[model samples]
Target: MGRRLIVGTTIDRVDDKSLTENSAAANRTSLWGGRFAGGPSEALARLSVSVQFDWRLAPYDIAGSRAHARVLAGAGLLDPEELGRILAALDDLEAACASGTFRPTVDDEDVHTALERGLLERLGSLGGKLRAGRSRNDQVATDLRLYLRDHARGVAARLVELAEALVEQAGRHVDTAAPGMTHLQHAQPVTFGHWLLAHVQPLLRDLERLRDWDHRTAVSPLGAGALAGSGLPLDPGAVSKELGFRTSFANSMDAVADRDFVAEFLFVTAMIGVHLSRLGEEVVLWTSQEFGWVELDDAFATGSSIMPQKKNADIAELARGKSGRLVGGLVAVLTMLKGLPMTYDRDMQEDKEPAFDAVDTLELLLPALAGMISTMTVRVDRLVAAAPVGFSLATEVADWLVRKGVPFRDAHEITGKLVALCAARDCALDEVSDADLATVSEHLDPSVRDVLSVRSALAARITPGSTGPGPVADQLATAADQLTTWRNWTAESVVPR
Candidate 1:
């Protein structure tokens, strides 16, 4: 019979008057009540999301249904025979759908109906009581929460990869000296590894936010039918456990209406996007001809159509552009919830698109950025060459005078005079010989010239969190250990397909 049907691939089914109905059997109050009496106008059904979009929640819906079936069996609502038939039918329906043998038609309207209809067809009407305690309001909300929890981990895992990539880069460049900036002007000499590790710290906070959001979305809303608790004696806690939720929602109204999870997830994504945008801005700046502190691999860069010499940092530019979209996603969720009431509303349909977009954008962006960082070359010689051009070692010379019994104010004045003399001569501080130094201050002895050297200035910073080699090497070891722990945890949690 199956082979015969496969030849032409047509199967007979019953007519569906339910599709034209303004609401499903679960809700009698029509969305457009005054306009219609019997069924919806054809124009309205075409615009509804129930038939098109809600079907995507089928897997989550079926999983919830299986748990609900067990709840119903435990509550004494179903006899053993009826419970067996319902369980068998639901399992058969899931398998058929999973194997691509089931085709849900347009008339079924949503996953809820498609599932019920599939069950009835398989078990010859014994599957009718399975949905008695539920409504699509709570069902979809539960499904969406489950879906978000699963994918939030995925987003978190990708973020860990990006963080690890940054740590790896930082470890490799632990001793590489680079110019650190404030207000886009050279401020001091810092290790390139320190700068890379700085980016990792903010991203680690982003990872924590993601992991926390996963726990927040781990609650179930299955037994909250419409705006009130279901009349049936349902075991919501049991259902929550079976479906991998951490808790049952406390209030039925809140369970059906709350979209805080979506908002929070988008907020986390937006903040992370802000961090990525900052990284992108730095990469774009460093890769420029004027800075030339870092060189991007050609694969991650692009050339202008007209200018042959133009190798634009297009990957970073795209990352920067996508951050606006992430910000927009957060704004959209907040806008959707601004005036929503205490229960479920059509306005909540705006939730999934933003959540999905934020996740999708980050998944593409994080891995691409990791790849870019892994391949990009650092111009250490260029950075070191640029470091001294801005008199970056001036502070060390001032400090040396302070240690020689000159008050800090006097030392600062002395260093200022010496710097002024060097500027007037158009020579570097180190280039000013001991004879020229003694002319500025008697404290500017032969030893003062040693403090002017960049290497000496860097080595003088032996304090914790300084740009000196010892503290930088300590930071590298700490960062590597943290990254290793995160990688091992992530590797163990690989959810199988």
Candidate 2:
């Protein structure tokens, strides 16, 4: 199937519906309506509904319910027959939900409320037993964790795919020389492979971040019971194990209240965004007329509507632009979390939208970027030709002088002056007359010409992890190994395909 982002949201104009009907199904939205004499006002219903976005959590919620049902069965809240029927009904409802045959109604308040309504319809009064010793507070917390944990696995998978693309490109360009830049000016000669591997380092760290995030996220909040321990003997550990969590939470209030996982997830996603933006910025620059170091594949580039000659790097531009949205998601979740007191609050419902939006952004972006990186043509000739521009070999001159017992400061000054002399004479560094080299500095000799070539400059950077071709080849090997390890982790993370 073609890649797409599927989300449930109320960010746009909402669908208008009448909530005035007094039916029990419509009123089922307000689980707390038991305390009120009358149902909520239509205005409140319209403003308060979260099924619009939270419905995306339905599958996770159902999974939690399945686990919770087993816990309830263990607690003897229901007999064996009731447990079997509820489990069977949950399976049917899950399939219906996944196939889109089942959906949240207009009056369903949130994912928890909507799923409960579905349960009630499926098993009648028997479904109400499953709600024993549980509340939406803990249910939502558990469900969100399940949802993000699963998606994080998928994110890690897609991220590794992007890294693989970079590694493959780096392999192709391992011997291709390019100008490594500082302050937008060529600073040194480097293999394009080395520069590409530099981008992969941060992505490897991102994979580690996701792997670590899973550790903290694996504690289940399912039995927290509306911010207090359940009076019933629910086996939270059993439920946690059944739901694939490493452990059950120790504190009920903290379990429901803690949103550290979400905020951390936002930060992780934002960091990935920032990294991709940097890669995107380079793509934009390299594909431009001024750089001409890269050419986008026809499949990836778009034609400008007004400018017929333009083949725009829209994927790169969007990747760069959407980073702000990812950062904004982090900010949104953090800000919403800042003022909340202990336990779950309505404010936290807003968390899913931002979190979901970022996942949507990355899901669409990573594959497109991977394809772009894999297919786009690297202009090796342009890269090699530009490697020595802007007195790029001046550093080589300074380093050569340093080897000849010249102080680096004095050598720097001599190289600077030589560069100026070349600029004034409108010539290459090697093109300078021997007398000019003699006049510029006594340190300058005919042998300085030996270090002026791009190949020599590339070979001179021999330190570990330097832009030298050997280190770059090693870097690609290291990156490929890291990508392999992460690929194994995602495969075991148990996220549905």
Candidate 3:
């Protein structure tokens, strides 16, 4: 029940006779080991075990089995009695699995092996007939697609929740100006709302990617055998319809080997992690003592164990850090697929852990990041004061000169000289004297001071996608509409149970 350190180095040393006996014992119970002389030895068994991670797929696996049973009955491979008995056994096994009443043993090499073992326990020799028209290659592929399609909706729903936080916060600060940056230096004034909405844009794209990925993933691979399809009269379309797939496999070999759906899911989740990481970076910086622009609630933050004065943005930090893990998962799966020739290879077994890790990582990370965004407080006074700091409104001065018939290149040079003079005098762009402004450039008039304030600067740029207040308002409305569309999407996607 607790941690224990092992201080021994004795490994299992099996002689040839004992190895043969162990392998022979494994052959009878093992799936697809009958043709071989014996099954895996100790080294192979240790390397071959996959039931541990793959057992989470039991529910989807069971659903696939139910569909397969109906197809088997239709194909006359199983009588009505056998089909009824198989379905009942699967139901019992599924319930047992869900309740922790049954589970994979160490001897079971994979989820398919474990489930077959369970079925054999239930129906004796009749359980063996269930494997007649299917292969683990098709089963695993179908199970993974079903599992991901269900979880994708779940992940997208959480994303919409995060977007809700962003839109809600954006709505409140629609007119509250803050210093926006380029290259981490003050570049212009923008509403805090616009910054929040920027995070949502990427997430909306992620959600859209999930929907698109689902469309490509909706085909069923249940009847695809190891390489080619079966000689039996199994109706893949019937299996597909029962399992809620849009269609069945077009090519059995490709169906058996396809991990494209898993790869696309990894890419989508990795992009989500990147989007969350960017937002996390901003939260860490903005909530720091120097920025003082935002504050996190105690519920969403953490305190250090030894350092009494430390309140840590561990949630944000973890979200930021997990981006690498997500990206690594994508790269790992891609690399695994790069060298595989065709059809089911043992190398493809390496794909599940990384893809599963991506789903688990985002499943845990998204809600916490959303809560952090929702509960954080914006320091309005600090934001407004900092909005025009470092002459962020200097762009307005340049544009003001351009409006007065000054060429942009000449206007740019004049603004640069004025900025240099202000720096030399240790003052702001507007703090330099009117005479100093004229001395800086005759293009400057006292009326050029009109656009110096952050509010004036924000109001001047009223383009649809700009950071100006009216544009920000329009985009906010657009964001709200997008969230509504997302909610409707999650509701309508019909994720499999």
The lDDT of each candidate is 0.76, 0.86, 0.83
| TM-score winner between candidates 1 and 3 | 3
TM-score of 1: 0.85
Candidate 2 residue spans exceeding 4 A from truth: 1-29, 495-497
Q: Which candidate is the best by lDDT?
A: 2
Report model 3's TM-score to 2 decimal places: 0.93
Comparing candidate 2 with candidate 3, which one achieves the higher TM-score? 2
RMSD of each: 6.6, 3.5, 6.8
lDDT of 2 by residue, 427-477 (tens): 999999899999999989898999999999888877889888888888888
User: Using TM-score as the measure, which candidate wins?
Assistant: 2
Off by over 4 Å in 1: 1-36, 50-56, 81-114, 117-124, 405-410, 433-442, 488-497
Candidate 3 regions off by >4 Å?
Answer: 1-28, 492-497
Worst 10 residues of 3 by lDDT: 3-12
Candidate 1 residue lDDT tens string, 29-137: 2222476567765676555545444444566677788788889888888888888888777778766766557655655555676777778777764677787788888
lDDT of 3 by residue, 1-497 (tens): 11111111111111222211223444346776668896677898888877767776777787888888888889898999999999899988877766565666657777788788888989898888888889999999998888788768778888999999998999889899999999999889999988888888999899889989999999999999887999999899988887778999999999988999888899999999999999999999998999999989999999988999887888999989999999999999999999888889998888888887887788789899889989999999999999988878778889999998999999999999988898888898878888998898888978888888988888877888888879889998988898898887766533233
